[model samples]
Target: MGLNYQLVLWNNHKKTYDKLIVLGMLLYIILFAVVTLVFNSETSIETLVIRAFGSLAIIMLHIILVIGPLARLNSAFLPILYNRRHLGVSMFIAAFIHGGFSMFQFHALGDVNPIYSIFISNMDYGSLTDFPFQVLGFLALLILFVMASTSHDFFLGNLSAKTWKRLHMMVYAAYALIIAHVFLGAFQQETSPFTIGILVFGFILVSSLHLITAFKEGHIDTAKTEEKEGWLKVCDISEIEEDRAKIFTVEKERIAIFKYDGKLSAIHNVCKHQGGPLGEGKIIDGCITCPWHGYQYLPANGQSPPPFTEKVATYELKLDGKTVYINPKAFEEGTEVNPCKI
Candidate 1:
């Protein structure tokens, strides 16, 4: 929503979101430390700190991964998606803390460089039980570092939306590495059923949500609609709620047909920023507001309001006895099409 590159301004909602994040992280870490000390009185302080932060990071990563699919499945989850980057950065901090402490505890005492020690400290990669799991964690941390550093709109603009999305998608790789790091490293020594159960539960939850959401999205993408005179028939006007949208996939593009002020307009569903699902958003302040980042565009022209230059392709919509029809051919970005009155 900014015309120039500058530090992102924190709104009241963002401030509250960040406060919750900090509070939750602090609470989790404290509770972890206390629980570990009570359960295993002989555990060292260094080990407690390492495990606390490491476990917190793992939990945060799970929450982060679940947010996207959850949002897609139900719009009620979109509020969390608004400031997900904050959670991501916080997760990286926890991970860095864990990795840093572990490096210092296990490798810093050796004559070789600490990072070098992670590789040379363990050469038994052939054995599943004695593999160099820290190396996997290190690589994952590096990927996370890249993502967290470039999480701002400045980087998104410079790298382009596609490139930025692809880069951030490295999260799945990082997740795999972290999973391996946990199983091959900690699980090798700790064989508690509760720990293993938690890991398995998290993995299953993340995987299942993703699969279900993917299937839903795929079905929508491949759905068939009646086409007449180069126009595709969508649902009736009553299907869409006021200020909401019903998305249709046409010509390999997802188009959002929004209902507001007793009128209908169609625009590219993909948000110009971060490629968010604009169809999932609602009308706010008379503009179509992207649920992901609050990016707003005029339904009449697919253009952002004055002082903003972002735009999306528009489509011509027609009303035939309460049924809506859309031309698959898209107009140029920011092209104004007269709305179809209800």
Candidate 2:
């Protein structure tokens, strides 16, 4: 596995904020160079500045769309998913640049109306092959704009997760349009076989990543299937070895019971990341660590500290005389239910 450089660095929230500001400063410099110097000097030339930005925007869109699924397939990609909305907003801003520049360069000027020029004599529409190529970019930008506008957690908190996911799924529709835009707008105009090969090759690479993810998660439904609640418990305080955890199978469910020092901590063995067995993972620095991607959980409370807020169903453990008893009820975060007595 590849080492995560960012994780190894000193983690300070304020420093992260400062880094973002630095990145924004650098981005402004590049955008200024392109919009003012590069395009302004060649406004009258045929270098296709607007179309080039459109291609750039579409490529960024592919990265934004793929990050979430990629993170599921490989937890190492989690950082991208953590800051995904920022990427979406960046992609929308790039698309806005492409769209605005195209509008002015090809649609405005002269004594004729801007509206008439936009729809009719945009020069791109003159060719039979590229007549509707620009429209694909326009429609895709609109979709991206919508998604970017609603990407905040405020929208996610107000709308149900199902509704939010449905709205965001439009990103895929935008992706398809962007592919069409690239094929017709850039490849057609450039007339270079190398460009076509590059575009097609990029598409295959993104699709292959997604296909690999699907294959890895093909048994996800089976993992979630309910287990028959016949035999599960395999312990008591005296039964479990000190500083170790035991796994028990219940209604298709796997649970972990840990005895640390004098306190007993019971938790779901399934890792929240991808159902990796938590019982098999090692305890590090007072936290139970998932062997897969090092996700940690405090078994006594069933709540993760920083960087791992994800949770799984937890059981309530009780000491009846010496035999430990467990309750099956599990609830959402912030619920009033108390975990097993530590």
Candidate 3:
């Protein structure tokens, strides 16, 4: 939201979120270590630290992945989406600890370099059960490091929002590598039913949530809209919920038709910040608030409030009986259009 970037634009909510995250992480690590010691007193402290941090990192990554789809499925999860970057950065820190200690314990002091030993020490690539799974973890950690390093607004501004988003999308690839690392590494060594069940359950839950959300959005994207003259029929006025939007694809671009306060306005669906799905957001204080970051815009003009110059293209909307219609052509950014009464 600025030309020059500071470290962080912290608010009371962000501070409270961060403190809760730190406290929860500390409590989880302590409790995990204590439980491990109680059951297996002979286990080394190094192993305990490695296992504790590794499990914590995996759990955090799962939470981070689920947050997006969960938020899409229900607006109640949007608060978690607001601070997701913090969760990702915290997950990376835990992973870094796990990777560092693992390399030290398993590969250090060898004649070859520890980093080199990670790849060469176990070259059983042809065998799934005996693969050098540490290499998978190393690569995943590298991706996580890059993503975490660039999670700030400074990088987003310098890299351009599209490029930044594509780079961060590598998180899915990193998640896959991490799954392979755990399956071919830990699960192979520890063939306990409890461990396998937990891994299977996590994989199924994360995959199912993403699939469900994708299917729901896919239906919306493929919806057919009838065009008459120059106006496109988006939906019935009754179909749009109050304070929410009905999104439609028109002329290769997405349009968000929001019904609010007994009136309707149309704007481009993409948010100026982060290209978030603005149509999925609900109107608050008479402005369309972007779901990802809470960027707001007046629906009539597709412009932010004064002192904030961000704007999106607006569309001319009309009503015929119970049907809602929008002109397929878009107005220039920030152009004002009268809201059609509901």
Candidate 4:
């Protein structure tokens, strides 16, 4: 939930950076396209590759855009949220390549103006047989360009989160447009009844899975952030052993109470990545290691040490007589509760 867009020294060109990821991805696309175009004994393989890659690219973009909203409903899906923008920008590049190829190869032949030809060539809005399919891709690409241009955190910071969220809602519209593009453009051309049916079935399957997850997660109020509760007695200070933690659920929130080296600290039981239970994780040196992915958080504050940035919210704790009680009231995320009266 914390999006600190502050300028920090990050090695963006590292092999892990999204640009390299997409660049390598596009390179593979180019390699495959070249191999298919060159070796296709039949002449139509090049065009088929273009349309197929184009559809694949747009569908991926839909997945990238929907992940954040999807994660709100499913804890298992948060890793996609943690790493989504890379996928967005990658899809943008794919769409751009697909659009450019379609324009140059199909529309720019002879003396046709590509832009004008793209619009006037297709007007099949009335009937399935006469549908204007190319327009759908053009419109979807436009949507993608707009969204990709503003995908950076700078825009998220400048435009308020709410406004940015609303603006980005164009993704759903783009998804529908691309689906229509696939049906009208490729399915209409290939009409190999079986392939077209398979494509539609695949599309429906992926979309149905997302819809089912969204329906399930829709009941969760992701907007509800702060956990407010009166002090709840958990266990005797003696019952909490060294280097171990007890977890409790209060107000639909899971919290971890830790006892390490005679000190008590409390943090959100869920890992920031995918809600891994922190209480079940072991301590490494001074950091509490997440049980699932080994993401480390300081026992003092939920902040990750140098070289990693993920954070979790921490709560106030006290040893009331021998009984430990938690002030379930949440503090500003990333701040530590030094519960020990040193």
Best by TM-score: 1
After superposition, candidate 2 runs with Cα above 4 Å error? 1-48, 109-131, 223-342
Give a tens-digit lDDT track for model 2, residues 225-281: 222252223455677776667665545566777777566666778765544567756
What's each prediction's clash count?
0, 3, 0, 3
TM-score of each: 0.92, 0.59, 0.91, 0.57
Query: Once superposed on the true structure, which residue ranges of model 1 sit more than 4 Å away at CA?
Result: 109-111
Off by over 4 Å in 4: 1-39, 44-49, 62-76, 109-112, 221-342
lDDT at residue 157 of model 1 (Cα atoms): 80
Task: Return the top candidate by lDDT.
Answer: 1
- lDDT per prediction? 0.93, 0.64, 0.91, 0.71
The candidate with the higher lDDT, 3 or 4, is 3
Lowest-scoring 10 consecutive residues by lDDT in candidate 4? 219-228
Clashes of 3: 0
- Angstrom error of the Cα, residue 108, model 2: value is 3.7
Error of 4 at 321 (Å): 18
In candidate 2, what residue range of length 10 has the lowest lDDT sum? 1-10
Rank the models by TM-score, top first: 1, 3, 2, 4
- Candidate 1 vs candidate 2: the lDDT winner is 1
